[model samples]
Every structure is written in structure tokens, then in C-alpha cells.
Target: MQGPHSPAPPVDVQPASWRDLSSIRELEKLCFGRDAWPWIDTLAALTFPQTVRLKAVSDEFVVGFIFGDQRRLKRTGWIASIGVHPDYRRRGIGRTLLVACEDLLGMPRVRLSLRGSNDAALRLYQQAGYVRIDTWKRYYRDGEDAIIMEKVR
Candidate 1:
């Protein structure tokens, strides 16, 4: 058993497959709660073509996940979702997943939306070179505005 001060286990970021459905579903619930995607959506995201699905595995368990939707015509990759298990926060896992998704997406521009009240997420995105470009009023189920952030290479 690891003590509170013990360093976290090594985490590996890799492509996620349909077999990760259950893990991803649980992660969605843990991360998004009411905003979590339906099972069908999660499955589709895992199986759909032209989408990037990645998972961060630590000690053989999924600790984080990211989904990137590539829109060729729009010339932008949308970060459909990203979440790290609560216990894994502040360990650079989210940022690692974000960067991995961006690199694999190979798009000139990448975008994502988040609840405006998520200060930690905002800081992470900002530190990763994302800038707020727009706001969708009442975008979330609870009427929280969604802040749209974009990073351009």
C-alpha cells in the first residue's frame, strides 16, 4: 500500500479500443456525472472512424481518457471529452492526454468546451496554450455556460 506521500505509479498513454468501454463508462460517470455521455455515445466514440480515443493506464487500470473528433472539412479537431480520475488529478495526466490527443489529431487547430466554473481545467488549458474564443450560454445540463477554448498550431 502506498502512503499519501508516496509517488504515483507510472502511467502510460495509449490508444484505447472498444474493450475499454466499461472503464471509459465508469470514467465518464466519475468525471462528468450528469453530463456524462450515454452508453451508446461512449461506444460510438470508441468504435467510430476518424476519431482519436486514448486512455491513460496505471497499474493496468484506466486512470484517464480522451476523445478527439477530427473534422476534415472544418479543418479542426474537437476534443470531445477528457477526464482524469479524481485521484489522478495534479499528476500531469490530463495534460499528457491532451497533448497526446492533439499530436495524434494532426490538425492545425484543436478546440474543446468546458464548464465556465471549472477553474482548474481553465488553468490547464491556458497553460497548454489554449485561449478562450467563445462562450455558449447555458450549454450544460445545469445551465452553466460552456467556455470554448482553441489552440492553433
Candidate 2:
């Protein structure tokens, strides 16, 4: 029998589609709380062209998600959102999703923004070679400052 100390199950990253809307929404809520995108925005990410959406699944459960937008004008892929279910964090799911999304985006550079107070996310981005590029004050609904980060190839 598995116990609390048991090893976590391995997850597979896969292309996400509209069918994953519900589970993705659930994961986002768990990861971002009040910052979670609305259902309509989630749907748009799944259905929109020039967007790369991916999910991490373990034992048939969606545990993480990422969305990236390909901007031809900028030759940069914008990582719009990325979240890992709380229970599945620290197992490398976020990094895997990020690498996969970046690969699929096929851009010369990538960018993303996160709440300035999200130190965990800041560390993750920094570890993945993202550098601070800019900051948008009161960028969130709750007036949290946004730190823009970018990775250039």
C-alpha cells in the first residue's frame, strides 16, 4: 500500500485541447486562486490558433497546464499561463511543461509575467534562464505588481 512518503507517479506532457477545459480550470484554480483565468479565457487558449497549450497528466489526472502564444511580429513566444496542481508541485512538472511549451512555440525568445510576490514562480523562471525585463505596477486585479521575465535563445 502507498503511504504519504511514497514516490509520486510519473507524469506525461501532452497537447491540451478544448476537451481539457474543465480539468485545466480546476488546476488553475488550485494553482492561482483569485488569479486564475476565467472559463472564457481558458476556452480561448485551448481553441485559439498560434497558441501552444500543454497539460501534464498522471494516472489519467490532469496535474498541470501551460499556454503560450506565438507572436510572429516579435519572434517571441509569450507564455501566458502556467500552473501545477498543488499536490503535484516540486516534482518537475512545471519545468517539463515549460520546456515542452517553449519547444513547440518555435520562437527565438519567450516571455512571461508573474506577480512580484510569487517568489516560487520567480525562482522557477530564474532557474529556467528567464531574466527580469520589466515591471507593470498594479497589474493584477488585486493590485499586485507584475514582473515581466524573458528568455532569449
Candidate 3:
């Protein structure tokens, strides 16, 4: 029986690399609007050492992507960014990608920062057992606050 964290049966999750730059860029723009990372930043995320990037594939399309920043010295992994294609949200892609990244990070704690008004993201993170531990004022480029949430093992 599939519990809450399972990916939709047909979804295939795999490690993502620089080859996915174009699709990842489109998805970032779709999910974050003005806050989407620039092409350079997106490229770096996929190629940077110590970063864990993954893509969710369905119907031969890259439907979701997630990447994390791992700090071995701090024993903490920051979920740098995550997004799902608009038509693919809430089908367990987000949660599954999150869990998969967390495992690959293999750190004692995982944290993520999200815009304060992102209700769907807040819900997903909360359901994944993250608790808000801090907030950064005017953290986003448009001046939206960033809610910092963390999950500790």
C-alpha cells in the first residue's frame, strides 16, 4: 500500500544534471514568476559540486525538479529550490522530490526558505514535518518575507 510519501505510481524520479538546464529554467520561471533564478544561477545549481539535483519524469517530460545545498561542515542541507509544472502540482511530485532530496543530502537537518505568501509550499513543507524557526524580512527580490522552515532528525 502506498503511504502518503509515495510518488504517483508512474512517476520516475532521477538525478538531474546540467543537461536539464532548459527544462529546469522553464519550470523555475513557471513556479517562481519574477523570483525565478537567472540562467546563470540555474546552470550553477545543476553543475555545482556538493549540490543534489533531481528531476521528476512523467510521460517523458520533466515535470518537477528540486535541488539542495549541502554543507557538510554545518551538517545541514538547505533545500535551495524546488518546483513542479503547473499541471503537475499536488500529485505527490513535490513531496516525493523533497523526501528524495533529503535522503540524498543525508544530513542531520534539512531547511528551506519560501516566500511568506506561498500557501501551497507552506502546506507541503508543514505536512513533511518542517516547522518555521525563523523569518527573514524582505528576503525576496520583491520584498516578500522568507519563512525559514527546518526538519531535524
RMSD of candidate 3 to true structure, Å: 4.7
Error of 3 at 88 (Å): 0.8
Clashing pairs in 2: none
Where's the lowest-lDDT run of ten residues in candidate 2? 1-10
Which ranges of candidate 3 are over 4 A from the true structure? 1-9
- Those runs of model 1 whose alpha carbons end farther than 4 Å from true positions after fitting are 3-6
Clashing pairs for predicted structure model 3, backbone only: none
**Residue 101 lDDT, candidate 3, scale 0-100:** 98
What are the TM-scores, per candidate, against the unseen true structure? 0.96, 0.96, 0.93
In terms of lDDT, which candidate is strongest? 1
Deviation from native of the Cα of residue 98 in model 3, angstroms: 0.1
- Across residues 28-134, which tens digit of lDDT does each residue of candidate 2 receive? 88888887888999999999999999999998999999999999998999999999988888889999999999999999999999999899999999999999999
Q: Write the per-residue lDDT of candidate 3 for residues 1-153, one digit (tens) a residue.
A: 769997565888999999999999999999988889889999999999999999999877999999999999999999999999998887999999999999999999999999899999999999999999999999988888999999997
